[model samples]
Target: MASHRVMKIYTVSGCFPLIILLMSTMVIQSTQERTDSIFHYTYCAIHQNIQTDEEMGIADLLSSIAGDIQLRQLDLRSLFPAERFPIQIRFNLKNFDISSDAEYSIAIHEFGVIYEGSCALSGERIVVNDGNGSQRTSASLRPDDTGALFMNFIDIGISLTGQESIVGRSLVIHGNGQSDLEVKYNSTRLACCIIGESDGRSW
Candidate 1:
């Protein structure tokens, strides 16, 4: 019995270091996975009230159109110009009416104007201007049966690089998919929200 107990203790001791090393490796891997995982931002896009005459900011527009609709889970970081990193946008639409044939586009604005350039992902693309001073076209997006729009794996071309970062920009969903060159800009502004960090808060 004494010899058996000694052998058991020796075996346990011999394996202890290897077990600890494995555990430590697992912990490191978990941390790295979280760090590398794609992070996202959320926004609430609401329809603008036609009765209001006051020029309101994006925040005020959301407040005015409160209780009308809820657009959430927009990935802000994906807008950062990247070639290899494909961006995904997932959002739930609540109390909002969307036609099956109607088209829409997501526009980003910096310094109160649409950013001048374009980005392409996959075979689809979005442009701010067509270089001839014409309104740019937007990528077509469709909603699922659950009223959720999942724009997955969008590869923004080289437009969002260098001096421009999508941070502190305004994102607007327009009706009829009109760009900034619309004759009546405010008529097409469907829902608007300022890009912000993801902190489980609604904007």
Candidate 2:
């Protein structure tokens, strides 16, 4: 019994250092991961798109929590006028080639870009209406009656009432993992604007 006890003690003594070394390695690995995360935040600029509709300021929070990158303070005067395009072309959603005779506008929100279009096309147009007697009939994006589900296209339209509220109507946009968007309408004008926190992701 005494010999067995000595052997057990010997085994424990031999294994204790190994266990401590393993724990030290784990701590080192965790520290390295945190250091790498700090570096990424310090160097990489963050960007977000309106299609996602994610209203969280994760990018700015990351820079703050990481304590590596300096947060830039933008002047309120630098903000774009609501009447003009915040970014050149406004509400930078998916870059699309659309034409309309009516006014068109788009706004960038925390989640995504919301745009209203009421323009007419000459040949092969698609017409979208706001369902408030404001029929935006056009030759653009006129899906056939068969309703062929193109996984790469989406369309939304709203009335341009010179207000941010969508009381008149809204043509909500949804994508099917595809890479196309189309919204064309008639002589009705559309109002576009940008509404979101401009710290991390803007224009």
Candidate 3:
């Protein structure tokens, strides 16, 4: 019994250094992951369409959450030299009164862009809805004739360096009254949100 105990002790002693080394490596890895996250920021924002019906009351808080877009930042310059880094767009918009069959356009505008004004002149259109152009027909996104939508897409070809991140930029969704079949003139701005940065996935 004594011999067995000594052998067991020797085995433990032999593994002591290796165990310590493994623990140290784990700590280093954890720290490096945190550092990497700090350098690569993520962002998200939420907004709702303008309520045209003055007779309508404010929506309940549960429904007022409206829609939100959580962007997963990426560096595509090295992976796809010809393409620009994309913004991952995910949102659940509700209470759309679409009927005219007009198209809606989504775009990212410079910081300080307001929802009441048209930004199509300088805004960068985001590709969404299965390779369709930024502008798409309302009927395509409406949910089962419910006039609501829950859409998600990854918009490519819009380059954004650290100096020009989505955070603080305005994301506008345009509605009816298009000019020349484009959002260039008299396009009704429906909704907008100023994106905000998040530390991790808690946004």
Candidate 4:
């Protein structure tokens, strides 16, 4: 009986670590898979509002069509070691009577200032360029035979998630001849639109 008890004890002790490791892996996978996403923001730019600021004009009329940004990757938002969550930005914009196929850089600014029907930008560029495994900036103005430009960014390296909230900011399009922020009064900025927040059902 003593030998049998000792054998049972040895078997249990030998199996304990394996059981614990399996449990830990299951917990990790469960935590990783439990993430969810929701669309909680909106940014709409219009042609009549933002097109007049350019020197020559990137386009005569530009407006947003069903653009969307979402607050996603719920798992990474809370972590012991902070990590970056994926930001998904989907926007559809059309510029009527565009002149060329030059590429334009898109950036989010710190402020959304609308003055005299034109978007006035201030502060910093919150999200731009490509880095951290995502393409966050630059867009091509693909003009068709009609001389109109159509721009669509669908998961092509743009997202709305940021460490700091980017709501109530400005999305500006910069032309070829200038840095995103130029001079004191930046009249060379091609287009500007205010970023707003909305629920999935409304706006």
Best by TM-score: 4
Error of 1 at 95 (Å): 3.9
What TM-score, over all chains together, does every model reach?
A: 0.44, 0.17, 0.49, 0.50
In the range 1-203, model 2's lDDT, one tens digit per residue, is 11111222245677888876776687777766654432211011112122211464321110010001111121233343343111111222322213322222222222223322211111122244544456553322222233221222222342122243222222222222222222211122122222222223221
Candidate 4 residue-wise lDDT, 1-203, digit = tens: 11111222245678888876876687665654442232334645543334444675553333331233232223344442354444555445455234543445566677878676555534566655354455444454444565444433343233455655566777766555443333323444556767766543322
Q: Please give the distance, in angstroms, between residue 44's alpha carbon in candidate 2 and its true position after superposition.
A: 12
lDDT (Cα, tens digit) per residue for candidate 3, span 30-68:
776655453334454545433322356432111122466
Per-residue alpha-carbon lDDT of candidate 1 for residues 129-165, written as tens digits (9 for 90 to 100): 4334565545444555544553443434312223433
Candidates ranked by TM-score: 4, 3, 1, 2
Evaluated at residue 136, the lDDT of candidate 4 is: 45
Model 3, stretches more than 4 Å misplaced?
1-44, 48-65, 75-84, 113-144, 178-187, 200-203
Q: Identify the runs in model 4 with alpha carbons over 4 angstroms from their true place.
A: 1-37, 47-81, 127-162, 177-186
Local error of candidate 4 at residue 137 (angstroms): 6.4
What lDDT is obtained when candidate 4 is compared to the true structure?
0.49
| Clashes found in each candidate (C-alpha, N, C closer than 3 A) | 0, 17, 0, 3
- Better structure of 1 and 3 per lDDT: 3
- Estimate candidate 1's alpha-carbon lDDT, on a 0 to 1 scale: 0.40
For candidate 4, the 10 contiguous residues with the lowest summed lDDT are 1-10
Instruction: Please give the lDDT score at residue 196 for candidate 3.
Output: 65
TM-score of 3: 0.49
Local distance difference test values of all predictions, in order: 0.40, 0.26, 0.50, 0.49
